[model samples]
Target: MKRGLMIASALALCTAGCGGGASGTAAAAPVPAPTPAPAPSPSPTPTPTPIASYTPAAAAIPTAGIALPLGKCVNMGNHLEAPNEGDWGRAIAEDDFTIIKAAGFTSIRLPVRFSGHAAMAAPFTIDAAFMTRVRHVVDLATAAGLNVIIDMHNYDELMAAPDANAVRFAGLWKQIAATFAAAPATVWFELINEPNTNLTNAKLPAIIAPALAEIRATNPTRPVIIGGEGWSGIGSLATLPMPADPNVVPTFHYYDPFAFTHQGATWVTPTPPLGRVFGGAADIAEIDRNLQTVRDYIARTGRVPFVGEYGANDVAGVPVSERINYYGTITAAYASVGVQSCAWAYTNTFRLRDGDHWIPGMLAAIHTTTTLR
Candidate 1:
């Protein structure tokens, strides 16, 4: 009876914060084990699309340049909340963009997840209304001249039923592509966000290739950024064959040696230990090795490398300066190879460098470029 009471207490507390998720059969996958990437690969096979006749309008130059400027971004976590998707307005105001713009960020990454609507197919339907709420943010970013990258964030079904996953992923993309059919060049369609250890990076191209074909079928030549698996690891991206679309960019994320970045992050079960130290000198060495894997691939493949997300956690003990310094190291590696990048976020989560007050300094650090500086 006493144990039952404690279980009830725990359940009530979890529901209070991030609205309880329905039970998931997906167990956490393997930790990032080091796997040597295979030989320098050829481009992926081309798949046909229905819209073969459609030529993209005068292509808008992608924000990616040989050396991308330090653009800022935030991950938008909530979309369809409360009563309706329309009611799903930003808890923070539009005025926040003023601060963002002033801080010198030129982009935003919107992370949205929706399900249970019919259009996304049998297992998922990220209701059309829900997508509209997300569109509003994209519109706002474009109005502000900030590039927007819209992504399917936190979808769980694929991870649970690996066999049936292809239909679920492909259907979601078809629906999303049809819904956001007219996004401007400045807006990007990211196929998936951090498919990670859950989906072997090997499975990504098969799932994503069909969707890429689907998107181009409607709107030929919109830029698509593909995040790699194994939690979008820099080292792991080397293993996955990047889908080749003349306009597509191979995307990877960084939160490496997570002991430092996610220290004391209570979100995971079996709480990660405190004093989870890393980010001393050796990290740079590891980063260099990782960057080389990417650099070599890009040189071999001629595809642009986009570091879609990179950031440091903001523990009270870890001064924001350290985070900025970390950026200097990672971005420089990207810059050295002429790779473009977008920082992890614009919002202030305990883990991300906060944009609330210190954004100006952070911006100064991130935006430093040989030409711009």
Candidate 2:
């Protein structure tokens, strides 16, 4: 979930009261004009029809534990998720996958703004060309021996108006599931990236349930990742609704101690100033406490968590060393408790690359592997 912010305004309501004359009118009063009847209260919008229950073709169901192998992943961000690829100054290159695999990453999270490329009306057909383009990229990554997380990202309209867009959301997934139904299990589906705005914690179940139902129709038992609202921070886990389906994996994003991780992030309002430093003992302790929350949640609920995104921006004034320490500490912290994580990006603000090569120590820091404590 790229952090550019957009807040939606609340809809305004207006009401009018009907006026009537008293039965005992003054003698001088002429026939009072007939009072207009108050307009019938507008009918409440009916809830959308839920999808019919469907059993997976037995052959299509996968065995358990398929969603947990997401070790040492990195996000391929600011590319397809942008309103248009290359609009954010980085475009996916075939070799980029090769580089990531070589750098010791096990998977890649590819965020896509499908809403921008799909028809706005019923069926919400994704543009054929765009769909093919996404497949081409995913195929390239999987071919490079990297598991790919195909995420539905940047669906701002759906976030702002979940009820109005719920059908289109399901339609998009129906098409996506059918397209990848036969692909290797290495390809995964992430329901929506960092859901926010009107899609509150309470409202998320209604929005995601239909999409999951549609996905199971074709990709039964394949892992589907779901994250909580409020930008999917760790705390959101407390309120996130876990669907009854066994294959759904709970996910969350972390960029905690925001004063340190997002020190100079321009997209954040009242942007945190530059010059923040991390890796003090307290910082590391804070990281542990945060991750402990995830561990506790897993223990309490029996659902494993995936760190869908985490990183510190390499902004000016924030030392490169501090950024590296943040990555290493965060990565190792999650690993310490048996959770898998994907760094925020490969390039752009929080880049892990310098042109064709890994940025000096960045890879070594984030790629540190630790046995679960």
Q: Tell me the whole-model lDDT of each prediction, alpha carbons only.
A: 0.51, 0.69
| Leading candidate by TM-score | 2
Candidate 1 TM-score, true structure as reference: 0.71
In terms of lDDT, the poorest run of 10 residues in model 2 is 13-22
212-301, model 1: which lDDT tens digit per residue?
887888768777777665545565555656665666666666655454454333433432344433445556566666656765766666
How many residue pairs in model 2 have overlapping backbones? Answer: 0
Stretches off by above 4 angstroms in model 2 are: 1-67, 368-373
lDDT of 2 at 289: 72
Error at 320, model 2, angstroms: 1.2
Candidate 2: the clashing residue pairs are none
User: What would the per-residue lDDT of candidate 2 be over residues 1-373, giving only the tens digit for each residue?
Assistant: 2233221111110000000011100001000112322222222332322211211111111232334577678888677877678866468997889888988888999988888899988888999999999999999999999999999987877777999999999999999999999888989999997766588789999999899999999998888998876667677788789788887888887776565675554444335566656665556666667767876777677777778888876655666777777787777776666676888778754778867677788887774234211
Best by lDDT: 2
